[model samples]
Target: MNKFLLTFKDSKIEKDYQENKLNTLQKPIFYWLLVMSFTLNLLKVILDYTYYTVNNQSWMNVGFVILVILELFLACYKKQYIKYALIISNLSAGLLQINFDESNTFPQEYYSYGSYYAMLSVVVYFMTDFPYSVFQVFIHLSMKIFFTTIKSHRIDMLGIILGLITNVFLVLTLYICDWNSRRQFLLNLREVRWEESLPFIIKKPFYLFTYKDKNMSFQVNRAYNQDFFPYYNQEDCCGCNFRQFLRKCKVENNNLEIYLFDKRNEKLDFDLVYQNKTHKFDIRVCAIGLDQINYLIILEKLKLLTTSYIPKQTNLRQKIFQIKKTQIKYQHQKHFLLGVFSMFLYNNKEITSINLVDVLQKFSSRYFIISKSKIHIVYSDRSIYQLITYKHQLIIYLIQLFDCLINNQADPHSGIKLLLNQGLYAIRLKIYLTNRLKFQEQYKDNFFIQEIERNILSEEIDERLEISFLKKVRSAETSI
Candidate 1:
């Protein structure tokens, strides 16, 4: 059972490590594609306009204009902006072709027109996943150069040479950048994998040590052996000098053993027993059932090594406390003004125009103490409001209130009162499920009534007050 639990724990850690790596990659890929696509579309529009002005061609111009409108609509309509960008660019490029007949009087010029296409090729290089962009750029540029030479009715050696040189340089640069990016990404992944695997090593007996004394001090020598340890034999003479130290001791199977030596070199007479063989060393010590000791030592070393590599994170308890404090401050300020200020701000105005950010900024500045906390407000109408608070209590209270509202039993005006009076049995039912306790034992009797009254008095007044204010004053209109 213990082995199974350890395996499960290891699997969980591995899963978390993989998830973090994936998340890290996701943001960079997303932004790279987004910026690349946006730039490409802008460039396409410019090129299309310039081409039409230069060649007096209306068909390509019309087609490009329609594509631009479609791209805009697609960007706004789809939540996956990068995917839309990919689709739009692919569609536009697939339809674009250069005429090679000089008689047409509007054949695509290699340098003047193909340069923009080359720029688009670079964008595609960065945005695409693999050889798709590479092959596409190669084909597109080659075809453009071929058509330009054919239309000029000559080799067009200058244009061909320039095009070849530019394509070579662009492809080489992109290849190097991609290789370096992928190499760095893999290195980071290896580090994450190593960290996730370290716990397994800590769970086993992987180190041996000995201690020697000289002049009321001791010198300790420790040897670590594991499949993962690469620097096991680097210690000189297998010992380290220390002072102001006493004898070293450990307990095994409820028995304690202490080592005392007259000189620092005297403690070098021990052996490590492994695989049914004894390996004698100058200063060797064997430990049995000392898993906890090894774990502590490994943990201490890991803590020191990772201090500079890992970022410091705020504890969840601290975050909750800060959010609660901010909520309380907002409550007090609202109470002092009797909800008049909120009413004045949101009175008969479109909720969309209320400028949630501006309100949060003002609130944060006014209640300076809670300025550091993050606040989020969720409305039933799919609108999210946010503020920063200093404590988690307010968030907890709001979450409970929101839960009741979601279940369709709590009135916003007198939230806790309505919930207690009508939802007492329901609240008790929830408490039983949440606390894993019998409803009869926790509520005892009629305790729900008192809870409702207490909660009603403490519930924040922002939502109901804002709605009422919006309904009453008709002149303070805001735009959506």
Candidate 2:
């Protein structure tokens, strides 16, 4: 009874229909049917050319066939107009055939068309929907039966009755087959839907899901959302409000009461805490039924990376370089600026690059020699490295660089090449420097950091540095 009346009794099938999910297999079959329709209509016109012309109905057949051909052409490209094309073609062709051989009416050619309703049902079966198709089938069958009875002047249009039975049987067979087809289609469609987004569910993973049900406060129809969602449950965790799972995961943020009732906001701001990172999401409340609403929260990770930067009148690089002279404290200090490894030294202050940062404390006329080109200075209050370099140009470069770190008028170019450590690339200026808070943040980088740190530029610390380092350590020990 259900199949006869409603072709798709399954809720999922109905949903797939609403979503317009045509399976891959359906396309080739539909196109083939369209071609077959065009060819058959054209062939009939060609074969019955004499007959139509003799009756002076040649233009009528030509125009009617052209309409079907035009409709089929449109249907091949534009899917939305297909149902109308199918309906129009089926009815028009059937009605035209009615007078063709009115005397020779049979079950196969019921006064004269090959079960138009049955053919319509077959095409409908290939479509993405069923309710409209079923209604159309019912109306068509009913009209055919009524017309047949009126023309025959008897209630026994048993041939049309047989056609109706064939259509119903065909629908029943399709309904049964649709059980699996709908399931596969839904699974594939769902993956495609979420797998594609922020507008889709790709970038933002589902944080929470709630649908209203009187028996159950709500139902959780969550995907395996552990990747984006902070909270993970082994079971269906339904409750009031959206963040009920947050409480279960021991998240202490307030408003975690989780509303069981449906809310009507398409884009409400929501927050999530997963992997100890706080994320903001858009709450999409989609009501499925009058009492049933589905809440899907997705975490937009890109919002952070793509956040609009506050436009400033001055650029960042220019502002950073333009330090206030008052804050600089240049004080005409003749400090050694280690010019090796792209490192910037203030009387040993802050430096950042894409290399080793050698921060040194107060010292004067220090001879720091890595090479004629290398200025490796790693000095601290705890572990001080003293340099003794005799190079005149190196001395000038160091003095100029030290001034550059603090003074506004100091030249950054100073006619020298530089390389700083990425730690990324983390090498050692000193053990104390390695343990600093700034370095600790990225201490967990690749294994290359520890390797690079163990060996800071093999050629930079050669014979000159070894001798200088030895002498300084000895002097420090004696002073201590």
Best by TM-score: 2
Query: lDDT by residue for model 1 over 1-480, one digit each (tens)?
Result: 022111113555445533553345433554465555456556655764766345433455456556656656765575345444554555456335442223444434634555565565566565543344556567766776666565557787787778788778876666666555555555666554644564565553233333322333333333232211211211123332121111222223221123433322332333321110111112234232222111112211110121222112434335334444664433333332322222222112132233333443354333333222222332232223322221222222233332222233222222221111112111110110222123223222322222222211211122122111111111211111
Which parts of model 1 have CA positions greater than 4 angstroms off? 1-55, 68-117, 161-173, 203-480
Candidate 1 C-alpha error for residue 43, in Å: 12
**What is the C-alpha local distance difference test score of candidate 1?**
0.36
- Stretches of candidate 2 off by over 4 Å are 1-19, 22-32, 50-60, 69-79, 99-121, 126-128, 146-157, 160-480
lDDT of 2 at 429: 31
- Per-prediction CA RMSD (Å): 28.0, 19.3
**Model 2, span 1-480: residue lDDT tens:** 154434357777565653454334444555666677667666667756744433433455676668867876787687666656655655555455344544433555552355554555566554634555555566666766777677778887567768689779865666666655566566656644653432443434453455445554445555433333333222324333234454443223443334323234333344543422222233332333233245555444412111122223344334334432225343343232123211212122111221112333221223222111222343333222222221222233334433432232223233222232222111223221212343333332322222222111211222211211111111101110
Q: How many backbone clashes does candidate 1 have?
A: 16
TM-score of each: 0.30, 0.36
Overall lDDT per candidate, in order of appearance: 0.36, 0.40
